[model samples]
Target: MPLIPMKQTVTRIRTEGNEWDGTKTEIRTPMKCAINEGTKLVRSMSGSAGVQGTTSSEAVSSAQIYFDKLADIRLTDVLEYTNELGITRRYPPLTIEIKRLNGKPILTVVSV
Candidate 1:
């Protein structure tokens, strides 16, 4: 079984080495992924007010990308997604997790 019936081919862009040392290297790899774009609620609580507590939530752009279990992805890596119309968007991974889906392991990445 597959978690997604359809997947898109995207480019994973990862940079290695140190910028200060002029050893920066960029690696690009093709990856099959399922991308979901939506809004994520960011919550915050303030306790500066005396005898009062304030909680706030802000809607932010978010994307969830699922990759193969063996995908070499990192938080510092950026994903380049090209739509069917040839429009491209780049997103830096904010979180990465390995989880089981449909009785198989997969890599889940969140970008904001």
Candidate 2:
């Protein structure tokens, strides 16, 4: 069992393409998930080829969605989330992790 309930809805969009005819198809599936949305500080560096460097840190929006069961979600799939106001946001999976409990798969978390 997950500590937090998976009550939010997220759509997983999978794109498949045919190499022979240059055609593509998209399959969308809605899943019950719990999303933890927040911002993380990311540090970046910039410099010229031979010049000095400048380091900066910025806060970037990050979200992690959790599922109770094994989901048919891939790293290549795009995840779409919509709010109550009808604003849709899409993101690709940056990382995917599976959690096990008592030697059984318990939860899957995808970060975007």
Candidate 3:
């Protein structure tokens, strides 16, 4: 027997091409997803250095969200997270890394 898990409903927004007037179009779908977040320190290049080419070390500690769903998510899509507070958060587009578990998609979104 296959194990059945509970599901959560989330709004899926995607770019659906442009209109004849040269305007962007979007497609929204209501689906089930699981969301989680974590924090860690990341190191990235700041800017161009001098002729010496000596770069400074900087550590940024920030939290990132990991959203899991059975649908395909795009980099240009915005995730709407719903909470009990009746406040809907519109998440900006970020680099999405996807992994599959039991033939389901798990999207890991990070802040840029």
The candidate that wins on TM-score is 2
Per-residue alpha-carbon lDDT of model 2 for 21-57, expressed as tens digits? 8888889999999998876888877776876665788
The candidate, 1 or 3, that scores higher on TM-score is 1
Q: Each prediction's Cα RMSD?
A: 4.5, 3.7, 6.5
* Residue 71, model 3: Cα distance from true site in angstroms: 3.0
Model 1 TM? 0.65
For every model shown, the clashing-pair count is: 0, 0, 0
Model 2 global lDDT (CA atoms, 0 to 1): 0.86
**Model 3 steric clash pairs:** none
lDDT of each residue in 1-112, candidate 1, tens digit only? 3456437877989889999999999999998888877667888878674654647889887678877664678778888988777878888888777787687676555554
Candidate 3 structure quality by residue, lDDT tens digits, 1-112: 1123325456778877677767778788875544543335555454555444434555543324445443466767776767656767777646666556777754544442
The superposed Cα distance between candidate 3 and the true structure at residue 5, in angstroms, equals 4.5
Off by over 4 Å in 2: 1-3, 40-59
Give TM per candidate: 0.65, 0.76, 0.51
